[model samples]
Target: MTDKLPGLHMRIPPQPITERSTPRPVQRPENAGAAFQEILKSKLETSTLKFSGHAQARLRLRNIQLDAEQLDKLEEAVDKAAAKGSRDTLVVMDGNAFVVSVRNRTVITVVDRASAKENVFTQIDSAVLTD
Candidate 1:
């Protein structure tokens, strides 16, 4: 039986253990959380508004021009609509009406004051007036 297991009786020499070099200290920014928060805030503010192709074309065809302030208001309106769980919303700001898809944060169409006078807005769950 012992002769049949000759190869299984072989011994392996152990290697000496060496001390490992200490790892370098990881340097982290002191205000990393604050920096991340600031970046998130800026991104949220800048990416708030998005216009669809139809909305852009409607705006151009209607000769509607929205300045920075008006755009900010519209964005705020969309935010409010989203907060209230609105999927489709009608946002009226500065006499301009915008049909917004709250879930996508996109403007589907624009209606100027003149066109909005007697036009009916459909498929909207909520309306936000930012005037």
Candidate 2:
């Protein structure tokens, strides 16, 4: 060590700067549009539509009967509801009422013509009427 004056300080070395590498591309599901179209088409073509447990019970209790034509109308209503980004929808067909889940293509509840007279639908984002 060399002799130095009082209150002297030592210098430190600097760190090297490194370039960052490029990030990898993000992964996502393929054929989203095709999948949506396929599901919609399948639902439209089916002879019958699916109902949730609560809806089934309500149908039995309310004596609501849906013929093939009525089911087709319901499917069409659901297709339109899905198109408009409706998650929960109220579909009215021939005086009957249905609460549908658009994303899952399911009818969550049902109200017959008689019950529908005084029914007030809630928690639905959209309503479609099939005359």
Best by TM-score: 2
Give the alpha carbon lDDT tens digit for every residue of 1-131 in model 1: 54566567677999999999999998999999899978966765567788999999999999989899888889889878876889999998888899999888899999999988889999999999885
- Score candidate 1 by TM-score against the native: 0.65
Off by over 4 Å in 1: 1-46
Q: Where is model 2 poorest over a 10-residue stretch in terms of lDDT? A: 40-49
List TM-score per model, in order: 0.65, 0.68
| Cα lDDT of model 2 by residue, 1-131, tens digit | 88887887877889899999999997867988799989977765563457999999998898788888788789889888877899999998887889998888889999887777767899999999888
lDDT score for residue 73 of model 1? 88
Name the best candidate (by lDDT): 1
Model 2: lDDT to the true structure: 0.85
